[model samples]
Target: MSATPNDPSTPNTPNTPNTPSTPDASYLVDGLRFAFGTLTVVPVRVTRWDREAARGGMLWAPLVGVAVGAAAALCGVVLLALGAGAPLAAVCSVAVPAALTRGLHLDGLADTADGLGSGKPAEDALQIMKRSDIGPFGVVTLVFVLLGQVAALAQAYGDSWARGALAAVVAATAGRLALTSAAPAPVPAAPAPRAPS
Candidate 1:
């Protein structure tokens, strides 16, 4: 006897009409969670960690940038409102993004610099990057890069609060957009073959 359509004994066939072939609303939500959970110190619970979720996360990662940028701009604006000097406000603005991201970006930058500066083979460079301690190259890169960011922000703030805030938001958003654009799409896993009935 043939099993009924609603029968529990029926095996699920591949590419069936009942199968969901496209991402649903929940997929987008999962992506959003992944973006915020991984990108910021914001307390978001990511429910999924698979390739589909990662693809979703990458799609939504730019929104995390917008949030970080806005928060950083707010910090600089608030400091300036309290009569803080342009340099001080700039420092706070630059600091906010670093704090929000738990310094991951800066850490990556340092690691990359260390790896490249080693002038080693790919495997050796990767090993250098994986080390816990920062090398001399990492230290120097962090110092110069941070100084440059502070200096640029200070100049913008000196001009006006609006300009400074705009600069902060633009910079942060652009950085994230660059990451998003450069990220490789996750390849979906192939479906397993059905067992012989």
Candidate 2:
């Protein structure tokens, strides 16, 4: 899994034959729109009140949603400008971004539903997430979520597509982040109690 100097394609890697590829600026820009989890970094420069938890690493998550919405609006306009039918534009608009992220949020969404919604104890629930198998909950959720996304894209088609895309990204990021926030952080290693004589 480790990239080495021998491989020219390694990202941010030094001493390589190939120049590092530049990440898509819009992707980077869209990522900063979050309040937690630093994966998506769409920077908005808006003031955020200090959070009580360890939410500092990701201050852009919410902004991603806002940005996605904005992106969606932009996409809509561009689609309209291209004069391509609404269906084509809507499909193409989201294809690149979704492909880039590799549908990570969709997987997470499925896993959360399967693991948390399963009628089992907490330990068993945790076990489900580790398994690769999908359950009824994951399937149902995936279907409806994708449907909702498509519907949203269609609805926002006539308007600003850029803003709409940004909004969609934000929605996806925020939903997953909420899933993340629901889980408890691993407990600190407990100090061993001294054995009494």
Candidate 3:
């Protein structure tokens, strides 16, 4: 009888040379690229989207926050240097982060609020969130949140420019750090068991 492919009598053919799965960049660089690509309007090319890359990205997310916050702070400081009022500076600072993120963070917040406020079954609530238009709940949430941020920043800026800039940086960094801490790390799947001969 001819030897079967899986039989010990059959010799194994040489396998093709192994290729690298990840890009040439180091793991840390891949993580930074993923973090910036996802979190900001910065034009970073993400080379990997695997679980390992995501894990690294999440860990590096706070750095993106730092950059965004610095930009916001700079806008506020510039406005102040131009002799603009504290409220206007606050508004511009608030707008800078929103613009940099392409309003993604605000959109997510609004969607989440709408979904929770629907008070329907999980499926229905999810559908409400998926709708393109903002709901009443979303509108109210966005208004109040934006108002609160503007007010707080105005107060800080009225006190001192340095205080306002520091607040923006601290708040942005804390928000990103919170998200990173809340996210669950990706777990590897267990290998499947082989059947007995």
Candidate 4:
């Protein structure tokens, strides 16, 4: 006996209510900003340096290596094309990444050497590592490691410039992988999102 309800049909409703129909562009932009900001000396405006952004940055670290490696490879290739010797090309190739990263990894290497050379307790070793001055161990380690890298790269370049470039890419990617894997979890948590300006 109830009156018939008015019938209505709609075909435009989204299957997921809270989700955006289109992909969010901001996240990709943020990830790229964080990646370049954290990994290289390139200038990029990063509005967020939070835990979420750090996680995103970690995911993109390998991409940063791709860029760095490409630049290094190009340098090597150009040197080879210009009839430069393999050793010179190799040295420049090694130098490219160092210049780009501002020798940050070299600093870490020096710190580690200093810490190990101290042979002190963990606290004292850490304190030694924190010093700005390079110790004997650090000096020796840097010389040997850098020489080794140049020698290896020169040998590879002797075989083929392409081989040297490929090696650079692989080494860069592996380095970034190590960095990502060694990062602590939770990323210290991000600060609260700021109010819109």
Clashes of each: 0, 53, 0, 0
User: Please, what is the whole-model Cα lDDT of each candidate in the order they appear?
Assistant: 0.85, 0.55, 0.83, 0.79
| Full candidate order by lDDT, most accurate first | 1, 3, 4, 2
**Pairs with steric clashes in candidate 3:** none
User: Could you tell me the lDDT of residue 4 within candidate 3?
Assistant: 42
Off by over 4 Å in 1: 1-21, 185-197
lDDT of 3 by residue, 1-197 (tens): 86643244454444311112333346678778988999899999998886556666887889989999999999999999999999999999899999998999899999989999999987788778888899999999999999999999999999999999998888888888987897675343223567998
TM-score of each: 0.83, 0.51, 0.80, 0.79
Per-residue alpha-carbon lDDT of candidate 4 for residues 113-196, written as tens digits (9 for 90 to 100): 999998998778887988899999999999999999889889989999999999888888888877678665544222456899
Best-performing candidate as measured by TM-score? 1
Model 4 local distance difference test score:
0.79
Candidate 3: residue 108 lDDT (0-100): 90
Superior by TM-score: candidate 1 or candidate 3: 1
Please list the residue runs of candidate 4 whose C-alpha ends up more than 4 Å from where it truly belongs after superposition.
1-24, 184-197
Give the TM-score (vs. native) of candidate 4: 0.79
Error at 191, model 3, angstroms: 23
C-alpha RMSD values across all candidates: 7.1, 12.5, 9.2, 11.0
The digit string of per-residue lDDT tens for model 2 on 1-197 reads 86743243565343432222333333333333323233333333533232212243243444444444445545655776778755555665565445434566667779889987898886688778767888999999988877776666766654655545555566656754664465336443234567999
**In candidate 4, residue 154 scores what lDDT?**
94
RMSD of 2: 12.5
